[model samples]
Target: MKIAIASGKGGTGKTTLATNLASYLSEEKQIILADLDVEEPNSGLFIRAEKIFQEDRYKMIPGWVENDCTYCGICQEVCNFNAIINLGTHILVYPELCHSCYACSELCPTAALPMQKQKMGVLKHYKKGNIDFVESRLDIGQEQAVPRIAQTLDYINSISDNKEIILLDSPPGTSCPVIEATKDADKVILVTEPTPFGLHDLGLAVETMQKMNKDFTVVLNRFGVGNADVEDYCKKNNIRIIAMIPDSRQVAELYSRGELVYDKVDSFKQSLDSIKHYILGK
Candidate 1:
């Protein structure tokens, strides 16, 4: 099963759930944890993986052949992202805004556009204990994470196949990068807290998951932080609360020390085991 742990907003313990779940499952079965949060990946911090390999993740961006150019605005006009702009005599390309779709190059009327590969990020693979950790780190100042995520997912496909389970740690928010990370996932575990903000974002995340036609369940982290608002929202939306991790100062301290929750709390291991059975229909 390809399980993706995601949240609509940041600081919702998505990575906590993903890393711990992989750690727990790895004890009994071979699993690969693919951290698709390329912009701010932190799974490696929690799981001590031995660096096995690394590769550069690249994307195609529009390159102007200045000599072959007819100073036409077609390339700029066709680019919906405003990645390319034609000023009277010069055409500029903004690599940050570019999605690397190559549309500008394809529609260049004068054929002055050529696609050039740009390094966007690095895909690193590591193995610690029994689990395999794969993380993609986007270069600073890089605004495009979808391509990096796609490249990471492709790397996961190339390395993993029909494994007992594959846990994907996705980026926060219901944006393009998040969508790309969660797309085609067999199941998604939405992690949230029991607060008003958590309830609101959970609804948006549920909507996003439904739109993507993915099966998902909610895992309420810091369950007693606020009130029953999260539970109420899930009840109204017909979403199942598979598990809950109560708020604990020790948990917070362990997290800050880069320790997995289940490793810190023995009881949490049972909860994760139950969640695994719930997901596997056991």
Candidate 2:
């Protein structure tokens, strides 16, 4: 079963749940813990993976062949992102705005546009104990994360078939990168808190998953600190509350030291085991 852990907002303990779940299940199963949050990947901080392989993740961008150019505006016209623009005497390619769609190059009348691969990120594979970790680090200042995420998924496919249970730590929010990460997941675990902000964001995340036709459960982190808005929302929507992790000083201290919560909280394992069983049944 492929399960993705995600949240609509940041600081909702999404990574905490994902990392601990992977750690708990690794003892009895062959699992791949994939950190698909390229912007700020922290899964490696919790579970260290021995570096086995590393490679640069690249995305295609438009390259203008000035030598072969007839300054036709076709390339600029075909580019939907405004990545390619034709000035009076020159054709410009903006690498950052470009999505590497190849439409500009393909529609160039004189074939003056070619595509070049730009390094977008780095994909790294590592193994620690029984679990395999696959992570992607987006290049600094890179705006587009979908291509890098696609590269990460490709690495996941190459390493293991769909047979082994995979746990994905997705990026926060309901964006394209988040969608790409959760696209093929069999079940999604939406982690939230018991606050008004958490309730609002959780609704958005739930709607996104429902639109994608994914089965999901909610985990309320820091359950006692805030009001019952999240729980009420879940009940109204008929969403199951799989786990409620109480707010604790120990969890805060462990998180500050970059430690996994399950290492200190023994009872957390039972909730994760139940979630695992629930996912497997689906």
Candidate 3:
């Protein structure tokens, strides 16, 4: 089963929940944590990912082959992003503006346009003890994050044997990147705090999940710090509340130092085990 841990806002503990859950569950089941936050993936920090393989992802951008040029304006006319502009004397190709749609190359009447592979990001796999890991790191100053997120998911899908448990640490928000991360998940755990901002964003995230036809539940982090507004809203909407992590100084210090809060053989372990049983039903 694929369980995605997501949030509507950043710093809501998606990685905190995902990494600890994967560590505890890997004891019995083959588990892989896919960090789909291409913009800034941090789950690897806690899990200590040791990469095994890597693949380069690229998009096909158009470039004009000057030797075979006929000064055709068809390429410019077909480009929707203004990627290709043809002046009478010269044709300019802006690599940044290009969407890599290949329309300019196909519409070139003189066959002077060629496709060039532009590096977008690197998708890599890692192993640490019983857990396998996958993450995508987008190039700096790149705007195509959703595609890289998709690429990361695709890597997980291709090598996954179907018997393992997949947990995706999704990007925070209800935007395209989050959608790419949450789609096709068997279940999603929407992590949030108990504040007003948390409740508001959780509503948006819930709407996104409903529209995508995904089954999801809520995990209230830092429980009891804020008022009862979040609980009241969830109760009114009939949303399932899966887990509640209490606000404690010990957990906070551990988290601050990049330690797994529930990885020890203490009461915290029991809490994590209960959540695992709730998720796997075993």
Best by TM-score: 2
TM-score (C-alpha, index-matched) for candidate 3 = 0.93
Query: For residue 28, what is the lDDT in candidate 1?
Result: 84
In model 3, the Cα lDDT at residue 141 comes to: 85
RMSD after CA superposition, every candidate = 1.6, 1.3, 1.8
> Which runs of model 1 end up more than 4 angstroms from their true locations?
none
lDDT of each: 0.87, 0.87, 0.86
* Residues 1-282 of candidate 2: C-alpha lDDT, one tens digit per residue: 789999998999878887888888887788899999999999889887689988988888878899888887888888888888899599989999998888888888878888988888998898887789999999899998888888898789888876788999999999798899999888899999988899999999998999999989998888789898898889988999988887888887898888888866766666677777776674
**What does candidate 3 score in Cα RMSD to the true structure?**
1.8
Q: How accurate is candidate 1 locally (lDDT)?
A: 0.87
- Model 2 CA deviation exceeding 4 Å by range: none
Model 1: per-residue lDDT, tens digit, 89-191?
8989998888777778888877788898888889999998778899999999888888888888888888887765889999999989889999968989999
Better of 1 and 3 by TM-score: 1
